[model samples]
Target: MQVTKTALKRIVLNRLYDHLRTHYSVSLSRATFVNAEPEAHAVDAATAFRSDIEIEELQRALDRIDEGAYGTCIHCNAELPLEDIRKDPCKRICRGCEKFVF
Candidate 1:
């Protein structure tokens, strides 16, 4: 059976939880980056940046859902396929208008 939008939303919520956990993990503490070696600091910054992006994307997804625009391509207004949504509930653009993969 085809999955419903509510199910897709739940998937996004679950992923948001995972990203939040990673962003707040004890081992990835921001305080440790303050006195770490240059390489370690760089890694920490990169990790933090990635986590931030992930969290933002998930939040945007939730917003889009509330707007009744989830699974709709933001760039071209195309309807994103259910398969794509299943693959990534946070995706906001369709493949045709996609300029970057992340």
Candidate 2:
């Protein structure tokens, strides 16, 4: 199904909220540090770090949506395929640019 700009905006916003919630829940505090076992604390720390990155990226996507740039390839300024956006709403580049960048 072809996703509209509105849908993409909603998806990004939802993802941003979810990531922020998870990050906050997992990040270590003094209480958590005292209570968590070493291995579990380490794992939570790693997960929190990944969630932090995702939150940043998703926030950028929301900014792009507000700026009328969402779903466009950042490198080429082409409209990204709806399928690609549906598959990964946080993706900022099109498949073609993705090949060159990585």
Clashing pairs in 1: none
In model 2, the Cα lDDT at residue 18 comes to 51
lDDT, model 1: 0.62
lDDT of 1 by residue, 4-79 (tens): 5566656665565455556565444433332333234433353454546776776577667766778888888888
lDDT of each: 0.62, 0.63
Q: List the residue pairs that clash in candidate 2.
A: none
- Which residue runs does candidate 1 get wrong by more than 4 Å? 1-3, 25-51, 99-102
Candidate with the greatest lDDT versus the true structure: 2
* Candidate 2 displacement at residue 20 in angstroms: 3.9
Q: What TM-score does model 1 achieve against the real structure? A: 0.57
Q: Estimate each model's TM-score.
A: 0.57, 0.59
